[model samples]
Target chain A: GDQVEQSPSALSLHEGTGSALRCNFTTTMRAVQWFQQNSRGSLINLFYLASGTKENGRLKSTFNSKESYSTLHIRDAQLEDSGTYFCAAGSNTGYQNFYFGKGTSLTVIP
Target chain B: AQTIHQWPVAEIKAVGSPLSLGCTIKGKSSPNLYWYWQATGGTLQQLFYSITVGQVESVVQLNLSASRPKDDQFILSTEKLLLSHSGFYLCAWSHGLGGATGQLYFGEGSKLTVL
Candidate 1:
């Protein structure tokens, strides 16, 4: 069983529209990190959340440790935002090994 | 202020050839290091990790092995490459805080192609 699970394995959004991605953890997680992998294959860190919500530009993320889930929201999507989004959860294990979701491939069309 | 360097960027090699990838960390000391592999269009998979010099732990075996010969260097190598070994290799390091909240920073990554 995968420790981290992401919803809507793929998504499409029209420019100026919005959508949200979610990750559910099977066990308690110490933190969650969201990343965007561009077409060029570079993984860019978006948000690293230990708890609560964080908003940057048109992107926002929330991590609920009690619920063992996290969500990323994108408002007014842009063409450059098209990429694969992954949410990884770090467990309490001493090594802090991260378990990543399969990823949500998002495409924004103008 | 820390930076990770991974090279050679990309490589192409024939099957059965030996392969080696390197990663170096700067501006940090005794950092926890990790190796992750992602197959074409696949999710990231943990391969190996090291907490200190001369101590490496294997998370998944894919005909690949890792070594932390020096405090700031981690190496991933193979005696003979397998076609299944082709993928994007990522080198990451963390501050080694007691909890998992510590963030892990990644290098530029190396892409391998096995012909």
Candidate 2:
């Protein structure tokens, strides 16, 4: 079984619309990180959360360790937000190893 | 401030050929170095990690080996390249603490094409 299962493998939103991406963890993860990979193959860190939630600009992320899930919400989407988003989780066993989801491809159009 | 650099932005090699990829992290001393690989349209998988100079650990076995020659340098190589090895290779660094407690910074990545 996959350690991390991400939902909505692909999404589309209008310029001003909003959407959320979720990752369900099979194990009890200690922390999770969200990333946005641009067209040039560069990964931009969006958020790192151990518990509770975090917000930065138009992006907000929440990590629920007990429930074994995490969600990244994108609000007021912009053209720049069009990219592939990924969530990587670290379990309680070893922090050195992080498992990544298949990723959600997001496209924001006018 | 810290910056990670991966060498040979991209390369196209033939099967059975030898290959080497390098990563260097600057401005951060004794940072944890990691190697991640992603196949075309696939998930990213951790390959190797090094916490100190001359110490390397493999997280996945894809017929590849990694070495940490210097405190800030990590190198991935193989004696023979396989078609399955073609993908995007990324180098990342994090604070000495575990990723479970801190953030991980990544480099632009290197693209490999095995023909």
Candidate 3:
């Protein structure tokens, strides 16, 4: 069975502060995607990386296949960034099935 | 631009009752559809996925079944629901192929509360 573990289960940040959330895989993954679930339970896909790194706005993500791990870095955190962040690892096994990490709850306060 | 829609924002049902949830994708042709469940204090668990009409694959069977009646429509149903079925259900779609195929666009989830 494939497993994805996320660290820093919860985080609190002041506006403009920064931090990183990580996901480690039990098996090699072909790619990974990060998502933020809002209060309305809508998921916003932030990043999808097959390898290396990708950046969008104040968020940056990196995936190291050889290391079987991925990281999401948030810079200049804002109150709007408060939500539950999850990382889903896509397995190359077949049909691109994904294993999700227990989300990291982030709250950026004023 | 593409959009995904899920029906019935929330529901409350008694145990042993039947249940059905639906999802539809618009502005995308034959997209890969998926159903995911999230329990309280738990992670997202993929339940089913469909690549085309009339075909669906179950990932984790929590005593529920799914069907793809049309190219853009997916239905999840159970003849008898249990308390364990209470959770948040989400509908998602992806490009279905290519390197970044994992990138998913999700719809507002449907919450189920079985009493």
Q: Per-residue lDDT tens digits of candidate 1, residues B1-115?
A: 8889998899999999999999999998888899999998989998999989999999997989999999899999998999999999999988765644468788889999999
Candidate lDDT (C-alpha), each: 0.92, 0.91, 0.90
lDDT of 2 by residue, B40-104 (tens): 88889999998889999999999999999999999999999999999999999888754334577
What is the TM-score of each predicted model, taking all chains together? 0.96, 0.96, 0.94
RMSD of each: 1.4, 1.6, 1.7
Model 1 in CAPRI terms: which quality? medium
In the predicted model 1, the residue pairs found to clash are: none
Q: Which residue runs of candidate 2 sit more than 4 Å off their true CA positions?
A: A92-95, B98-100
Candidate 2 residue-wise lDDT at B48: 97
